[model samples]
Target: MKRYWKYIRPYLGAFILAPILMLTEVFGEILLPRLTSMIINNGVLERNEAYIVKMGIIMVLIAVIMAIGGIGAAYYSAKASISFSTDLRKDVFHKVQEFSFKNIDDFSTGSLVTRLTNDIQQIQNVVMLTLRMMFRAPGMLIGGLIMAYLMNRQLVSILLVVIPVLVILIAIILVVAFPRFEVMQKKIDRLNSGVQEALTNVRVIKSFVRETHEEEKFKTTNRDLKEGSLNAMKVVITAMPLMMLMMNITTIAVVWYGGNLIIAGRMPVGDLTAFTIYIVQILMSLMMLSMVFLQASRAMASLKRVKEVLDTEIDLTDEQASEKSAQIAAGKVEFKNVCFQYTKGTEDLVLDHINFTANPGETIGIIGATGSGKTSLVQLIPRLYDADEGEVLVDGINVKDYSIRNLREGVGMVLQKNVLFSGTIEENLRWGNETAGMDEIILMSESAQAHGFITSFKDGYDTDLGQGGSNVSGGQKQRLCIARTLLKKPKILILDDSTSAVDTATEARIRQSFTTTLKNTTKFIIAQRIGSVEYADKIIVLDEGKIAGIGTHQELMETCEAYQEIYYSQKDREKEAGA
Candidate 1:
């Protein structure tokens, strides 16, 4: 919560001005009843119509002043609150972007989304409400009580009893309800996670005919959320009725005591009337305070949740050491005894003492069974994840020494799952090179074998794509992603099973075209298919995170049993399909 003040600090003038205006409005409201007392006791009792009319005009003037002040206060409060939330949201988004893969994995995507949207919205509403009501409520309550006592101290005795009872009740309610609100937020995160998962895998649910099962799962989570919300509401509902009951009792006592006093000639009728109004004002003000506190309690919970994300220190930072004057020649990579594991204090390493190097213009193919760490190995070259034990060098300098922007710009990587943003085809291509011209786009698209289909669209380069490229086929999305990478013309290109969705003929055409156009770029291709790796300059076979074989196709066929088994198994599948 303190960290969030950086955003609020700029709005300090508005924050102060809003409450001051609100206090003036509250002062006007408090003074109105006293003016009424004077009108009733002096004018009506003395039979002075002129005095009554004059006081009446003064009352109307006070109301007008309050109205104007209220509006001004509301305007400033709204402006400050909105600006505060906008700045806070921007800061949160930027912090999330800076988080490393390890930090992201600790908080799942659905939970992070909930924090960014729902949690922040909760805090924003509370800030706006607090600025509007904080000064007005307290001042009205205290000022009304002081005025009521000064008007007639005899009737004020009831308030001494009433205020304490209400305070105790509110205190108990807050204590019980505060913890429940935190739990309710966690439940919402779980519900959001469940819904996000079901939506993302709707295709899988339909293909497996498991719609009923998915529906049941969603129902269970929805019920859990409902129950949590209902329980919290129940606490609030129970406490509110008790508060009302206390206020009602105080009202009855005021009327009872004041009536007795009036009958005995101990109090003036107008004075007693004003006293009752002041007591009601005090009670109402306390109720408003309780309401504000309730919201503040929930906002406190939300504030803590939002602060957790902002407080997370970035795990990776660029080295402050002076730059060494060594130059890394283009397309050269070396991993010296590199090892990694996702978690610390774990005996199992994902990649073990791995040593490998690829020279300029060479095509290195990585083939492995599932979970053999092929993707993880390539991720190190771009410094996506630092190695646990040894150095990963691109050119000649350790990757850790390079700035993140410099490191990523030199490497073009297409992940196994291709993703496209919502934009025109040309806008998406510009992500690779912002200044790429139409001719450059066409050349790269054709080289990646994507131009023919792209030009088939009604708008070609101007064709608008849906989010995640949902409007395009899987193979087409892969091709566009490949073309986008090709436009970068990076020194090292990494394709992580990027062509898996394309037909064999199209894959062969793309590969052949790439080989000719990307002659100066080193390519690292990871594939499950034997055919994909067969054309590589050299192939490395990984078995259980260890390199079992490293050689060309002909060399591995005679010497590596693991390579032979994989090759023959893929051959048998091809033969069966052909037959």
Candidate 2:
């Protein structure tokens, strides 16, 4: 919470002015009851109409002043709080953007989203309440006590008993409620995860006719959240009733004792009247202070969650890079005894002692079974995750020597899971090269065998795509993704099973275009089908985490056991289908 003050310091003027204005209201409140007492004693009892009228006018003026001060205080406190939240949210978002894939994996997507939205909102509300109540509540409590004691110290004796009990109750509530709120927040995170997962896989759920199962899962999560929230609120709600009971008892005691003093002529009726108002003020202030403490406790949990993201050190920053390159003039890649694992110190390595090389303008093919580290291997080139041991080199220089932006810009990759945004075709294409001209875009589309279908659309390149390219066929989405990458004109291009949805004829044409248009670019094609990579200059076969074979398709078929097994199995499946 103290660390977050940098965001608040800029709004210090508003913070300062809000409490100062609230002081005016607090003083007016204290003065108003005394003025009423004066009217009851000197003006009404003595039948002094002139004194009554004068004091009444003064009371009206003070009321107006209190009204203005309260309004100003509310305005400034809101300004300070809202602005503080806005800056804090922006900072949290920027910090998330800097997170490496490993860093992101440390927290679930739902947890991060909750911290950004719900948790930040909780903190904002607490800040606003604190600004309004922090000074006003304490001042009112202290000032009310001073005024009550001055009027007649005898009436103040009741507070001695009530204050200690109220303090103890508040302390107990904080002790019990703090941990409950923390647990409740974790429950909210789980609830959010349930909702996010259900929405993201709604299509799968519907296709499988599992709507009832999904509903049950959601109900279970919702019930847990409900129960946790109730448990936390029970602690809070219990305090309110107990505080009010104590307050009523104190009021009754004050009146009973003050009445005896008034009748004995030891205390004036007016003094007794003023004493009651001060007592009410004192009790109400304590109640407000207790409520403030409860809110602060809840906000403490959210602050800790938010601080976790802000304090996370980005693992993939370019600060360690000692050199920068303007462009990847040549696409030559090599891996030397590389080993990597998703989790550090894990026994299972995703890629084990991997060694491979691709020369400028060469076409390389990667073939492997599922979970064979194909994607993990390509990701290392872009520095998405650094190798746990050994080295990855591009253009004869160690990859870690180059800045991440420069490294990634030079390598264009079309991932296995192609994604398209909700926008016009041109907009999605421009993500690869924002300054690309219309001719360049069309040429890349044609090379990727996407131009014909795109031109057939009524709006041509202006056609809008649905979210995740839901409106287009899988083949079309893959081609569009390929064209998008081609527009970058990168020195190295990687397609990770990107053409799987396309027919072999279309795939062949796309490959032919790659040979002609991307003659100078080194290319890597990772495919499950032998036909897709049979024409490549060299194909590498991966078994488990190690390279099983590396050669031309003919050489691999002759010399590699793993390659022979995959080729014959695929050939047998095709023959069975053909028959």
Q: Per-residue lDDT for 1-579 in model 2, tens only?
A: 487779889999998998889998999989988888899899988999999999999999999999999999999999999999999999999999888889999999889999999899989989899999978999899999999988888789889989999999999999998899889888999989989988877888999999999999999989999999999999888999999999999999989999998889898787788888988899999999999999989988988899999999888877777777545779999999999999888799999999989999999999999999888988898888999999999998888888888999999999998999999999999998999999999999999999999999999999999777777888999999999999999999999999999999999999999988899999999999999999899899988889999999999989999999999999999999999
Per residue, candidate 1 scores C-alpha lDDT tens digits across 1-579 of 476678879999988888888987998979988888788899999999999999999888889989988998999999888888888888888999988888888897878888888888888888888988888889989899899888778788888988998899888878887888898888889889988988877878899999999999889988988998888777778867877888888888988999999899988888877887888789888888888888878878888888899889877656542343333359799989999999888998899988989988899999989999899899898877889989988887788887776778889999988989999999998888999988999999998888998999999999999777878889999999999999998989999999999998999998898778888888999999989989899898988888999999999999999999999999999999999
lDDT of 2: 0.92
TM-score of 1: 0.96
Q: Which pairs of residues collide in candidate 2?
A: none
Give the deviation of candidate 2 from the true structure as CA RMSD: 1.7
Q: Lowest-lDDT window of 10 residues in candidate 1?
A: 320-329
Q: In model 2, how large is the Cα lDDT of residue 444?
A: 96
Report the C-alpha displacement of residue 424, candidate 1, in angstroms.
Answer: 2.1
What are the runs in model 1 whose C-alpha is more than 4 Å off? Answer: 319-329
Residue 119's lDDT within candidate 1 is 85
Instruction: Please count the clashing residue pairs in each candidate, in the order shown.
Output: 0, 0
